[model samples]
Target: MSTDSPTDGAGAAASVQRLFRNTVVAVSGALSRRDGRVSLSVSGLAYFLLYLAGLRHLGFGPSGYEVSVVSNPLVRAFRQVGPFQWEPIALVVVGPVELLVAPLNMLLGAVLAALVGLNLAVSIVAWRGPSACRLGPGAGAMSGLPGLLSGFACCGPTILLVVGIQASAGLLSLFQWLLPLTVVALLGTLLWVGSRVETAQQVA
Candidate 1:
């Protein structure tokens, strides 16, 4: 009976130690996640608000008058840039309510939200076990890509707003509208890809 008593006491002590260790780990993880969640929300909301404001200023129309094929002989010479030649193509002036910018803006917003969520996850894992996060500098950079992508999405509309407003005054007549078109196209493509990443996460 004496020996059995010692064995039972030792087992209870071991179990208590394990329970304490687990409790500490869980609390640490939760705190880290909470910190990351706040960061993500601040950054994401800033981008969403900025984009909405910029879109409001980019009143509808081809931005500047659409360049026609006849008006832009350079397009024929530059076949690759032909799609950008706004002139001659039938124009559809969109109303404020008909703005098509929402799709891409919302897409980027979604990616930003995911980025915040992933950051929180990583933080929690790191808190639970430092080795579990396994993210080096490269991984950190990769993780930040979604936020950068969101920046680009917002910048696209900003560029349009600037060029469209500038050209309206004939100040940038010499500067081709191709600049805005190409920038918009590139950023739009990136936002689309980022949206796909965000969508996949929802499915998972």
Candidate 2:
């Protein structure tokens, strides 16, 4: 048996810590620039709005101005209606705009949006900066595609599967895993993008 198991484990822990630290540093540095901030804000906002629109929470409807809350807003907010979905506890309408206020969903959307925004921010900054290593902004930009796709996957699982192909238990289970998979994808891509960016000390 290898007597260096403790050393190996310690090394693994240190590696993970270094990876996270580097990722954070890269993201922070990227977001510090004006162009990076603009990219982050625009991409994040667009994603969040599309996310809500996909969920039928935000759209154009009858013209009106009103705000209504469910009887138990707090309790209703956390009530799950589907895989990783919570019930909306309020409705807001302003002229032609309508919105369903679901706290949990909004929170998730924010997180996903931020991840995507950070990915783009870092990628953009890296591409514009002079780096010692070869960098392709496309790689980092495309990484967020899965997260975007998965967000739409949560809108509604395809009910019609090639007319006759039935969804198996395994396939059905996969639908439920989409959101979690997206989160993992987003974080993984963020780390990947961050790893390629300028380090904290080299940041300008």
Checking candidate 2 for backbone clashes, the offending pairs are none
Position 43, candidate 1: lDDT: 51
lDDT of 2 at 155: 36
Q: Mark the regions of model 1 whose C-alpha exceeds 4 Å error after superposition.
A: 1-32, 57-132, 141-156, 159-204
What is residue 27's positional error in candidate 1, in angstroms?
A: 18
Tell me each candidate's RMSD, in Å, in order.
Answer: 18.0, 5.4
Supply candidate 2's per-residue lDDT for 193. Answer: 54
Per-residue C-alpha lDDT of model 1 across residues 96-123, encoded as one tens digit per residue: 2223223434454455444433333433
The alpha-carbon lDDT assigned to residue 147 of candidate 1 equals 37
lDDT of each: 0.41, 0.69
Question: How big is the positional error of residue 8 in model 1, measured in Å on the Cα after superposition?
Answer: 53
